[model samples]
Target chain A: MNGDLSALPGIVALTLGVGAVATAAMLAPAVALGFCLARGNFRGKALVQALVAVPMVLPPVAVGFALLILLGRNGPLAFVWSALDIDLVFSWWAAVIAAAVVGFPLLTRACEQAFGEVDVRFEQVARSLGLGPLRSFFAVTLPLARRGVLYGSLLAFTRALGEFGATALVAGIIPGRTETLALGIYSRVQLGDESGALALCAASFAIALIAMLVAEGWLRRSRP
Target chain B: MSQRTSRIRCHIDRPGFSLDVDVGWDERVAVVFGPSGSGKSTLFEIVLGLERCAGAHIRIGGSTFDDEAAGLYLPTECRDLGWVPQSPTLFPHLSVSENLDFGRARAADRDPAARKRAIEVLEIGDLLGRSIDQLSGGEAQRVAIARALASGPSALLLDEPLAALDLPLRARVLPYLMRVRDQLDLPILYITHDPDEAQLIGDIIVVLDAGRIVASGAPRDVLWSRAVLPLSEALGLENVFEGGIRREHGSPTFVSNAGLQLVLPVSLDGDTRVRIGLRAEDVVLAADRPGKISARNVLESRVIACDDRDGDVYVSLDAGEKLVAKVTAAAAAQLALAPGSTVYAIVKAQALRRLG
Candidate 1:
């Protein structure tokens, strides 16, 4: 590796690309789960809530180990990949999955809080306005809670950028490919490259800080 | 005009409360009056289909929204009912124009004329460009109402739509409300706990108490009904007796309901539908009929029930119809009055103020 601007595009792509895909996965699943928890009335709601929060408390390595058993080539779900003729192990996609797993709780928790803070009166008013339940949610509930959704997205993105332990187990830092900024920092430190590790660490922190600031500012600007 | 023959029947069951009622409306405004936590908003929820209920049958203008027995149900979106809530809730992210357009776009009648008509009807054309956040509470409320009205709904359901405003702001919005009521043919279900608001706008009053409709009829009849004697005494309003005045004995005047005579100070005509005010404290009870007392009005009344609330004790008496009087516990003990006890009720004629 040389100190040249030629590799900047790949590095930028890695930074933005990993953040975007992993963040999207985290945001999508967590939001879906959040919506379910927020709106559903069932006997097992408390148990379901406990299940959603389990990933947040578990050790990152344990989470990676569990995923490895379910998703690895020799694991229980190996046939699923074989049937689809796809590769998941030791790939950039695996890194995205690991990052998403690490990031999902942040997104889901934020989304759940956002949805909870919403007043039920809005939905009632919408229904009384002649919109049905489904229409009311789309027309009023979703729009009113948009700020929270955005905040959750930003939180997920930051969490995804910082993922290390789970990605390390699932994807195993591969230079110029599966190597995320967090993984890159770890590798640099392991190889006794102090300057490189510090540089990457500072970059990652700056990215996360900027993301939080933007999200906070946007939410404040859009508050009802 | 079709609304005159139709009334809405709604049944709702919630935690700690349930409401079952069949209500119809004419061209006139029907105000649902009740105390706080009397399931007013919950009733609106069932009617609006925001909250689910079992065996609920609702109809507006003969259009069936829910028929549990028939297994027919129409969702809220198809119901086409406008709603105005107390809070001035407008979509914050959308400009007022977009918010107005949001409802119009979803409405089955999406004509430009309909959209324009809604803005004109609600009188919010000037606030179109402004964002929801920039609006004052009143402006936001107007926009919300306009957006709902844009849908071309069959009727309007208002859930304490003016409660969020202070008295002065409420006065400001009254004209617009009056205009809407006068100009539009739409039937409106106005819910309020305020007696003043009810008296101002209500043609028919449906009084709800503790999840049940206690009384419903013309506002005048319900307000001063002998059936609601207990409620009036509880409210500490001026209570009056309806009867004809009989011959005077000495300085005391007598008014008789049916054949039951009550003494008062005023001497008036013998046969007329007259109302007299007899304050709860002014009414003294005696176990036996009294003579030579300054109290002009006296009656033989049987105690119906007793309710001790706060500092005042309420004794409900049935003097043909019913009468409730608020007395101190000391006064109640002094009279030795309990349920099923017969007593003489005396009201001075001066207390018999005539009502129009």
Candidate 2:
């Protein structure tokens, strides 16, 4: 338990670092996708939307396998990146990218639903009032959809924190580097260090509980 | 060819229908009278630039918003037009004050002074800090109106803004429109199908029917023409007949359209095709024609059709064409007027509307 608990600081950093990256990756695209789905009329939108949701539905390990081939040293991605002299194979940053790929669609889907739920009537009123589309989106649409977007961001963060299979497959479980709480605990369990694994599991439970509480609070606030 | 505010004439072509409307504003409240789906909103949308349709050339205050001949289209945000939709679409996120500011591109001066002036004009100073959800329907509508007027637009287009509200609520907000007319001093294109509203707000009334302009002129003149007379009839206007001028001595009496000659209750001019309306309740039907009756106007006609609506009977009489009259079953039974019965349809002078 002492050794397990000593690893908490590094695990917490890994979780925070990965979560921040995931949120950064998801937020911009989520907003753009939300607006596009809310207002755009185009062919192949359905296909693009299904492709977005696939990462969410696919097993994290399965997504990792696909990414490994695409992003590995001898893979197509690395061949392209070879001229840039950047290594994506076994690094903490690679783990964050892996987490983001798995978590992005959840945030985006929630944002799309939120944006869709806002009545276009408000936008019409703003336009009539001389507020243009850019001003209208910021002044009306964004504020109305805030609660849903906020909750979606929170979910993305929590997902990135709990990510294990994909992160481990893409960015090997290097101690104090790529090892998040989930991956750290898994490594300890494989070594038969039951006490260490138990400590990490308790810490993960506490973080997950806090995340759920925040999400529930936001959900309640979004309603009447 | 002549331009004051510049005559607005545009032809907007959609899939199967086109909105071809021509309006010239000199110094009158022009009413766009039409039913829903008769391209009412589309007309306003083209003006506002929210919709794009070919061959729409719109100019307000000598600024062209759209000119299809020149391949130009201004976006809605830059149209500089005031608009009020049927639904009171107040921004849920903004307070009453912010909503007004969103359209205050007109007063480019001190922002606070502009807002203060808006609050004063709209009389909504107290509602400035209040959120949209807290406002009532009437309050929300007033704010929406206030917000539109704050911009000091070149043109104001109101699309049946009072239609969604109940009768009492509509009555409440009408005075504000009067204030807008007086205070804003902008050319208003008020759209509605309600005749009463048209008569009230319209200086020049344009009647739209089935995607075409059936009639357009001064309010009274349009409503009083033979071409537009049938519309007034359909609106339950009592049929007034020319009852002839002064029975034997000096008095003004008129003949009705159905050739019913009667004495004068009020002063009326020469024998003409004076169309009128009879309220079903106004006409007191009798079994046999009474000669010495106090009522001024009376006509003999046969019943055409009778149907029971609620507790009253809606009886149509074939005078010249179909003249609909309302009567109770008791009145119908007393007269024994069922389809083939010939009876006298008595009308008051006041119920007889003149079509010039």
Candidate 3:
């Protein structure tokens, strides 16, 4: 019990730090995809939408295998990996890439719905007031959709914190290198370490519960 | 150089209908009056550069904003024109002051005097701190207009800005619109379907029907024209006259166009030219000149046309001008009225209402 307690601070820090980086890396692409899905009209739009939805519907293991094929030592980018003299696999960066891939869809769908609900006439009015399109979007549309964006980022962060299957496959369970809270919990359970598993589970539940509460409060405050 | 005139010539082809119009204006308030689906809004959208138009040529203040032949097309932001749509578009996420400042910040001129004048004219100083959702419909509209004005556009386009308000609210907002037109020195293109609104503020009136300009002139001239009489008749204002108030035999009278004089109960104090409207039901028709009638005014007229409407006969008469009289078919048969038949149209002085 004392040993598990001693390891708690390090586990929490690793989970939070990795989750934040994964969410930040996914932010711009998620917002752009959300806006396009909500407002754009183009050929193959349905195909693009279906492609974005794959990560949400597919099993987490399948996503992990796909990433391994792309970033593994003998994978597609072997030459670049050799040139950089650093392997991405079994590293903290591998965990972030895995978490970002898995968490992207939730962020995108939430933001898409938010942007869809905004009236286009408001943007048009802004343009008529001498604002260019991009300026109007930032001035009018983005502020109106801020609540959804925040909610989506929180959801993505939470998803990243609990990421296990993809991170295990790509980043491996190296305790001090890449083992997140979720992976730590799994490794402890597999090794029959009951006390460590329980502690990690309690910590995960606390973080997720706090995230949900904050999200609910944020949505209420920002609703128009 | 002569005072610049705004000219618009455009052709917009839609699925079920197309709009083609050529018009020019230099008036302080140029009103676009039309029925629903008459392409009035489409015309405004084209001028604002929000909707694409083929072969569009728009020039304001001697600068060409859009000319297909000249291959010139400016975007909405570059056109420098303010727009107030029918609904109040105060940004939901902003306070009144912040919304107003949004436009002020983007204005090329950015004159503090103009911003101050707009805020004062709209009377929205007290609402600066209020959120958009807290405002009444009339207050929101005032804010929208003020925001547009703060942009310092050379012209303003108002698309039925008061149509969403109830009657009392519309009345309250109208004075501010008039002030903006009269005091701002900015040309305004006002679109509306309400005849009263068109008559009240229009320096030049353009009537559109079926996506075409039916008539364009001064309000009185267009409203009283033969092309517009049927529209007014359908709107229940059967007798519309523009005339000068005069004193005859120590009594007040109204002398209308075509040299027809009408006895009035009271004289207008200031205005010489007055617009008077009477309902069709108010005019009593007689085949022969009646001897003892309480009605104070009578006109010798010729019956021009008659139509049956819901068991009543709507008789059209030329009493030195066009007039409509609603009488029963039985009464028309008893009087033996027909085309070119001479008749006397009797109306009471109290029945005449000052329309504008």
Q: Largest lDDT belongs to which candidate?
A: 3
Q: Is candidate 2 or candidate 3 better by DockQ?
A: 3
lDDT of 1: 0.71
How is the predicted docking of candidate 1 categorized under the CAPRI scheme? Answer: acceptable
Per-residue C-alpha lDDT of model 2 across residues A17-84, encoded as one tens digit per residue: 88888788879988889779767889988987999899998899988888888887788777676878
Cα RMSD (angstroms) for every candidate in the order listed? 10.3, 9.7, 5.7
Off by over 4 Å in 2: A1-3, A222-224, B1-28, B109-114, B223-356
- Model 1 misplacement above 4 A: A1-12, A132-135, B1-4, B10-15, B24-28, B106-114, B229-356
**Candidate of highest TM-score:** 3
- Kindly give the stretch of ten consecutive residues in candidate 2 chain A with the minimal lDDT sum: A1-10
What lDDT is obtained when candidate 3 is compared to the true structure? 0.84
CAPRI grade of model 2: acceptable
Which DockQ value does candidate 3 get? Answer: 0.64
lDDT of 3 by residue, A93-131 (tens): 999999999999989988898899899889889999888
User: Please, what are the lDDT tens digits per residue for candidate 2 over residues B100-131?
Assistant: 77877654531335446556766888898998
CA lDDT scores, all candidates in order: 0.71, 0.73, 0.84
Prediction 2 TM-score vs. true = 0.76
Models ranked on TM-score:
3, 2, 1
Clash totals, every prediction: 8, 19, 0
CA shift of B295, model 2, Å: 13
